[model samples]
Target: MADAAALPSEALTPPGGGPGAGPGPGRAEGAEGLFVVLGAGLAAASHPLLYVKLLVQVGHEPLPPTIGRNVLGKKVLYLPGFFTYARHIVKVDGKRGLFRGLTPRLISSTLSTVTRGNVKKAFPLEDMEHVSNKDDMKTSLRKVVKETSHEMMMQCVSRVVSHPLHAYVSVLLVISMRCMVQFIGREVKYSGVFSAIVRIFKEEGILGFFVGVVPHIVGDVIFLWCCNLLAHFINTYAVDDNFSQASVIRSYTKFVMGIAMSMLTYPFLLVGDLMAVNNCGLRAGLPPYAPVFTSWIHCWRYLSAQGQLFRGSSLVFRRAPMQAACFPID
Candidate 1:
């Protein structure tokens, strides 16, 4: 009877009983917990939008008209732009074509989200509570700036930690069947994910894995900061402070806010995507379409030279409405 009573007390007591050693740190607490979080995140990150967005961005490059003879020997000119590329994807690979690079994207993005969340919790910045209704415009702007800065810091930290996965994601995005055929030509094809991975490893070695990290990190920071600021603005200015249990208004506000955020940040996303898959031809064992830009500045410079830096901005804006709603819906 005494041992049973003591057992309850012991279970409730801290390990040190002094202060710090209560429960273990929750950040990736154990191998099981780590695996579970990563597994769940991996599944969640395999969203169709991942592939769609990448494809849309990659298809921004204008393809030359392919001249061929029809059944009657008539001249047929096929030009591959965004829509044509999308059609080719569907015609060639069917529905499954839309899911190219899902595996590596799932892994990279899941790890990024998890790591960012952990880093955010561990190294919190200025509390949002300080920004109040009574604050002046300048004060409010300052608060938003702080919030954006905090988000960027957290994202950068996570990006570095997940750099290898990020590089793999970039490589996969570039060499995925849809990208390989549409962006390059049908001549170069990856057998599947495994073959693509091995091919990258052998061809470029370790540094190859870090191929597009710089652009990705830069784009991620800018997008996150802008999105968070916009969301904060909407939440503060647009949303009602008091709400009942089943608040349709709040839900709608969130949905609209998300869509607006997606649209606003898309240009930066275009730059990132361009830099990311910039090496697609090289990765496919063909001559690279453009010289490898060593940094974000170089990438931007190259794009600016071609006058196509904002090539996919319209497509991204058009897709933002559906893409953004997925966030709040999920």
Candidate 2:
């Protein structure tokens, strides 16, 4: 999957690619980036399990009161509850509704991934061969610093470039859903990615496009740093020096690390979604209400007041395994 996403950037890479090349290569690279992005979008949109995962994450489970019962205290007669949420989704919005916001998510994630990949490829790091010496801890520390620097740089570039799409994905996946109306005091009737783009832009302007971006960027850098450092620790102390044994240990560690990282960073993700949802407007002619937060700190205070810093964490736990599975793919 990473290879497919990187194909365009690699194709556009100048012959004998080297660090600090001229900006001319960057233009070709940008255009080529679109192909990989489209491919990523399709892949993300078509994944079967992702559909169910997304629905669950967006508060689609357990049936809302509107669909669960009627005013007379009798079972609300509705479609067969066999595939409860799936049936509800079809009944309410048709089959195509299951794919809501797929385009925005695809664009956001693909751009983020492609941008990071291009940056990493364009500025290849010097091989850390010197870090192999066991006699010096300085070499190990240097290696960690080098890897973290590259990763931080990639993440910063990717997050900035992808902020709009990321915001769109969050809004589409969770914000646009009426489930959040109780918290946000607004009902966003999702009309697909294009409609969302226009509405958010018109209502909230540039700032709306970046709600929760600070936490997202900060959490991303922390997650990457932790993952790299954990891998180094595992490689150094836990795993034996045997090549095959070390390889197996490394693989397992990475999977475990991915889930751990996801769990740790989930609060930031939750906060970001909340901020975005709160900022977006749904009803027309409302003159666009003020956003709930002026900054991530303000958002944190609001969530703290509500005691929902870890709201809907069960979905994140359910989602972690998939995150771990995709670790290598990214």
Deviation (Å) of 123 in candidate 2: 2.3
Model 1 residue 144 lDDT score = 71
* Model 1 / residue 21 / CA error / Å: 24
Candidate 1 differs from the real structure by a C-alpha RMSD in angstroms, to one decimal, of 14.1
Cα lDDT of candidate 1 equals 0.49
lDDT string, candidate 2, 197-254, tens digits: 6666777776666766777677677666776677677766767666666655655564
- In candidate 2, stretches whose alpha carbon ends up further than 4 angstroms from where it belongs are 1-84, 129-133, 169-198, 242-244, 283-291, 304-307, 316-330
lDDT of 1 by residue, 1-330 (tens): 011100111112222321222356653355335654654464444434444445444543333454445578765543343455566667767867655555655555556556755775588664444343535647877877877677677767766655555333334433332233342354344455566667667876766555655665665665556555665566566655565522445334433444544554455555555565565443422234456666657767766776646544443213222322343321
